[model samples]
Target: MSRSRRRPGRCRNPNWFGQMAVQLDLGLHRLGFGMEELDHLISDPQWCAEMVPDLMLAHLPSGNDRLSQRNVADRDRFLKMTAQLSGFRKSVAASSGIFLGAEFHFDVVRPGSALFGINPMRGSANPMLPVVTLESRIIQRRHLKAGTRFGYDRSFTAEQDMLVGIVSFGAMDGVLFSPRPGQKISVFLDTHTAPVIGSGGSDTLFVDLSDVPDRACREGQIVSLINHQHDLETCAFEHGITEYELLARLGSRLPRKTCPIVLPPCIGKQGAINTRDQTSR
Candidate 1:
């Protein structure tokens, strides 16, 4: 289970580890295990540690003074229990808990969002490599006249005649981002960028390409929407979506495949390579 307490429903109550079980709750600041089933398993001398869950310290938010004190007290109690079990095997830490300190590190760790360059330590330096890079291909490029009104309910009105590129991404693609007031946002086009001038549509994204080179703005060109320079994080933060949710929201038509590195033919006619990132061995 996850060590960070956020979205309690996601990281809690997983029933798949084993019948030889261990359990934890992030909100409970739990590390040691003695769940109903786990206690029964541990009582049997024949049961091995490997059959249980990967034990790790998880954080629950400090809600109030009473809760804070209780969490600390409970953590101390669990620490003592964990110490007794320590020599038997090292436990594992979750994505965000790796930075909690060496005391939390067992032998193994589950790299969740951390595997995708999300800062394990929220305010600290990110130590992971870039995992997913999102891009969209251009399908058409054309000129927009001044006073042009477009999009659903005519949400966009051109201030001047401008050239725009119709990229192969849209609301259905999970790229419809709502910018904060007066924010300057753009997309990566070759060595430069093109500004997004309006709300993203359902099947196509509109980018201002009036000043860009004609060749670079041509059809079939791939433009990066998410990149390594903290772009993924920025997008998630600004759009008020969890990192995992943002990634999951992307369209299914784009290239994505799970793997053990089997390079089979692409999916259908529009298939793209799935670049699932793994921590270096």
Candidate 2:
């Protein structure tokens, strides 16, 4: 039986067992075997003899609450308990565990968000540059009178006469967003920003374009949903989702373009990659 608790719902299949990578539940409760569970596996002579451990993995929780004493103690306990294991050549810290300290980083590090320019260390100035930009093309434009309702369930009513543009991107395109009470969500048109004003439609989004200049409000004009100013972190924050979820939820139907990275001053003429999602017009 696989002792790692990474996937609780996954059925344990004995047929596939050849070797094992021991997962230690350091702080993140979602995966790995607990200390008591580890002890059981270690003491079981028949199981120990059959299975060989390839490596130990301990994932430390990230964000503001990661530095708790209990987590540190758990890690200390894990180290002490795993010291006797002979075969596993390395200890690896996954994801944000790399930032916890050098001790957490043993032989390897598995970085996720940091690779895509998300700040692994939150609450600090982001050291990574923007790597993705998601744009939606305006497919149509309309003028609304005050009291006119817009989108599904009539979620928004025009407060005053305003110009609005419908973009070819919405909930179906992984833009699952809703404004909080008294809050506004926006998309950028060059230097101007237009507020999203209604329930997310399946394949279209309504943006109030009254603030954007007439020249920039033309049909087929690209409006940025994710840019340097409104990066993945910001968009995810506004959507009340994680950066990983936002990235993962992006619909596969959208067109993708990969271009050489010439932007961001720090790179300075170096070769890098940037991806753009062109969500139709």
Candidate 3:
């Protein structure tokens, strides 16, 4: 890995010895540095033994600036170091690093977000299967008077007298308050689709009753959190948090149901079907 000029206030110079261990396997014989200063460090046999690691794992730091220009700096440095070193068979790039394009796709790509159907970077196409669903139960429905205060702190005052449904989900369940009065979120109810409007709160999700007037969803009705056409990162940004935190913050009270996905039989393997019948039969 190419070393950067150590950031201000940092005592030790930034070195690539640790990063080199991760890209290459246990058998590392040589070490390269950014310039003569790093080269001198590697020259010390005792220092080389201590710094030269057998195996290493390079991961992007969490929190903000994770997928920004600094990510590019780290990725480029690692790529450069790997290229300079010989006999390195495999290299792996993490989620944001893959966005550097196919040039960064070495032997393998470790994609945690894409595997869960989340596009980490904005404006990029995601090619992974979605694996999460959110559902909420309705608790109550009431008709509100015009200018009635809703929720704690009297955040929302009704525009006019309207019916509202109290849902089980809230900010505790990852629902965030919207700046606008009525932000519509698409939800699936069995075979039917409907909209759930956002009401200001950190612990309650509200739905406008006027939007879906046909079917009456009473207490104990289950609604799915719609994820098909929306981006998770966009949702996180809307919620004023990082994508990783948004996923991590999903409340544990929500019950999860898992089902196995089966693929079609392999065509040419041992248990595969043979199309050529006459001679084989």
Q: Count the backbone clashes (under 3 Å) in each candidate.
A: 0, 0, 0
Which candidate number has the best TM-score?
Answer: 2
lDDT of 1 by residue, 169-212 (tens): 87877658535567756788888788876777788778889878
The lDDT of each candidate is 0.60, 0.74, 0.54
lDDT of 1 at 178: 36
Q: Ranking by lDDT, best first?
A: 2, 1, 3
lDDT of 2 by residue, 1-281 (tens): 55533232243456776656777876577877777778777776655666667877776654323555554665676677688677675554454556566666666667667767777665666656788889879999999999999788888899999999998887788776557778788999999999888887788888999988899889999999999889999998898888878888999988998877566575443333321111000
- Which scores higher on TM-score, 1 or 2? 2
Q: What is the C-alpha local distance difference test score of candidate 2?
A: 0.74
- Can you list the residue pairs that collide in candidate 1? none
What's the ranking of the predictions by TM-score, best on top? 2, 1, 3
Q: Highest lDDT among the candidates is held by which one?
A: 2
Query: In candidate 3, what are the lDDT values of residues 12-107, reduced to their tens digit?
Result: 246632443432221122432333434444455655444444432345442123346655665555565454334434343566556555555565
